[model samples]
Target: MSLARTFVGFSSTDINYYRLMTAWKANTNIDFDFVDCQLQNSINSENEVYIKKLCRERIGMASKFIQLIGQDTRHKYKYVRWEAEVAIEKGCTIIGVNLNAARKMEQDTCPPILRDIGAIFIPFSPYIIKYAIENYSMGPEDWYYYGNEIYKGLGYE
Candidate 1:
């Protein structure tokens, strides 16, 4: 299958989790892969406009946006939330990966921009995430989450 062009949004505090995702893809044993479209390097300026301009360019290349929802994700207005906003504007399929391991969107942790938009939420597991990236499509529902039966089918308890 062709790799899905994906952009991931997350708070700076959760960078380690994002790194782990990269590790999952790098490991030959893991059944996870995607063409990541994140910025290659940090922009050398504090200018929000310049930063956002670079981010927008990257987001435009993605067909999917995976938001790593951490404790401060809702409060991170600087870039994390804005990235999701741009992804929505670009018509990317939104996938909210709960770092806290929630199968559904947690009202307390989800960012305002992703709440009403058509998106799917899943735990931070590589299997479920890969499954979403491969199988999910935006539909009429504002939010989507797989039932336990579906997770069980994916070998999740």
Candidate 2:
């Protein structure tokens, strides 16, 4: 199956990071959209209800969530944790990509929840992504339909 929908979360500061996902889409010819949860001004003014509503307003909903687990994420943003939890609660498949060593030779790091959630670990590299996408047989159609059902149940409409 072809890889279709995916939820991408990263520090809004991480611009280059967004490009990596785009590159994957280009190479694989897959329809992948990145969900930007970057709190630009402040979440203080952002009401809880709106935040929850915006949380579910994805530009393109994907069946899989490629969470970029980094040290900065846990510190810089709390919403990352919330979004991941929401996705998991909704039963979306989460794929943990270790980009530490993928970019740097340094030891790779990942969020603790990844281990607890039993997320599949993939080396942060284009080669590994290609392999995983090919080996996994999930298309965007299945992802979109299933994700839509889950979101609608949660009042995404």
TM-scores for all candidates? 0.96, 0.59
- Give residue 117's error in model 1 in angstroms: 1.7
TM-score, cand. 1: 0.96
- Model 1 residue 65 distance off true place after TM-score fit, in angstroms: 0.4
The 10-residue segment with the lowest total lDDT in model 2 = 138-147
- Model 1 lDDT per residue over 31-149, tens place: 89999998888779999999999999999999999999999999999899889889998999999999999999899999978886779999999999999999999867589899998
Q: Model 1 residue 54 lDDT? A: 94
lDDT to native, each model:
0.92, 0.51
Scored against the true structure, residue 150 in model 2 reaches a CA lDDT of 35
| Clashes per model (N, Cα, C within 3 A) | 0, 0
Clashing pairs in 2: none
Per-residue alpha-carbon lDDT of candidate 2 for residues 1-157, written as tens digits (9 for 90 to 100) = 4454566665555547657766665654654333333333344545767765666655125556666755565554466666777667766666655556332111335554444454555545554444443344333321111233433443334
Worst 10 residues of 1 by lDDT: 110-119
